[model samples]
Target: MKIHDIPGFPNPLRVRVVLAAKGLLDKVDFVPVDLPGAEHKRPPFLAINPTGTVPVLELDDGTYISECTAITEYLDNLDGNPILTGKTALEKAMVHMMQKRAESELIDAIGIYFHHATPGLGEALQPYKHPEWEGRTYWGEMHREKALAGMHYFDSVLRKQPYIAGDFFSMADATVLGGLLFAFYAQIPVPSALTALLEWKERVDQLPAVIQASA
Candidate 1:
C-alpha cells in the first residue's frame, strides 16, 4: 500500500501513528503531497480522493481509501487482530463514540479555527473557503472556544480512566493526540486547570509508536 500524505500534518500524522502502532510503517510507501502548493486540489490527486484531502491509502489492487478513521479501521483490522480500534462489540462502540467526539469537538474544531479564523494555507486556497459573514475573526474565536470545551471534556474523561476509551489506548486516544497536534499548530492553548488531560498527553508522548510517528 502507498500512503499519500503531507508529513507532520495532523490528519496524516494520525494515520502514521496508527501505522507505527500496528508495526506496518515499514511495509508501506509514503508519498508526500505538496499541500502548500495546493496540489491536493488539482486533478491527479483529486482522482485518488475527490475530497482533495491528504493521507489517502492506495491499495495494491488500486483501491483508494480516504478519511483518517476509515483508513485506521482498515489498517487495524488488516492483521485480523485489531488493537487500535477495538475487538469486542462494546469496545468497538465506545471507541468509535469517543473517536467521533474527538474529531468533532477537538480536531475538526481546531481545523475550522485554523482555516476560517486565521489566514489558512494562503490566498491561493482562499477561494475554496466560504465567504466570511459574521467576520473571520469572530468565527475563528467561536471555533477556538469549542476546541477549549473539548479539552475540558476530555480532561474530565481522563480523570476517570487512564485512556479515552476505558483502560486501553485505542483509536479514540489517537484522535485526541491528533487534535492536540492541530491545537499546537493553531496556537490554541489548553486550559491550565486541565491537569489530567495534560498528564495524559505526557503519557501518550512516551509511547514508542507516538514517538516514532512524531519523528
Candidate 2:
C-alpha cells in the first residue's frame, strides 16, 4: 500500500500513528505530497483523491481510501485482533462515539481556526478556502473557543478514567493526540487547570507507537 501524505500535517500524522500502532509502518510506502506547493489540489494528485486531501491510502488493488478515521478502521481491522478500535459490539460503539467527538470537538475545531483565522498553508491554497465572509475572523474565533471547550471536556473525562472512552488505549486517544498536535502548531493553549489532560498528553507522547510515528 502507498500512503500519500504531507509530513507534519495533523490528519496525515493521525494515519501515521495508526500505522505505527498496528505495526504496519514497514509494510506501506510513504509518498510525500508537497502541500506548500499545492500539489494535492492539482490534477495528478486529485485523481487519487478528489477531495484533494493528504494522507490518502492507495491499496495494492488500486483502491484509494481517504479520511483519517476510515483509514485507521481498515488498518486496525486488518490483523483481526482490533486493538485501537474495539472488538466487542459495545466497545465498538463507545469507541466510535468518542472518536467522532474527538474529531468534531477538538480536531476539526482547531483545524478551522488554523485555516480560516490564520494564514493557513499559504496564499497558494487560499483560493480553495471558503469565500471569505465579512465575519470570517469571528467564525474562526468561535471555532477556537469550541476547541478550548473540547480540551476542558476531555480533561474532565480523563480525571475519571485513563483513556478517552475507558481504561484501554483506543483510536479516540489517537484522534485527541492528533488534535493536540494541531493545537500546538496553531498556538492554542490548553487550559492550565486541565492537569489530567496535560498529563495524558505526556503519557501519550511516551507511547512507542507515537514515538515511532513521530520519528
> What is the Cα-based TM-score of model 2?
0.97
What are the models' TM-scores? Answer: 0.96, 0.97
Which runs in model 1 stand beyond 4 Å of their true positions?
Answer: 131-134
lDDT of 1 by residue, 147-198 (tens): 9999999999999999999999988898999999899998887888999999
lDDT of 2 at 56: 97
Cα RMSD, model 2 = 1.0
1-215 per-residue lDDT for model 2 (tens digits) = 99999878788888898999899989999999999788999999999899998889999999999988899899999978899889899889989999999999999999889888888888888877674676777888899999999999999999999999888889899999989999999999898999999999999889999899999
Off by over 4 Å in 2: none
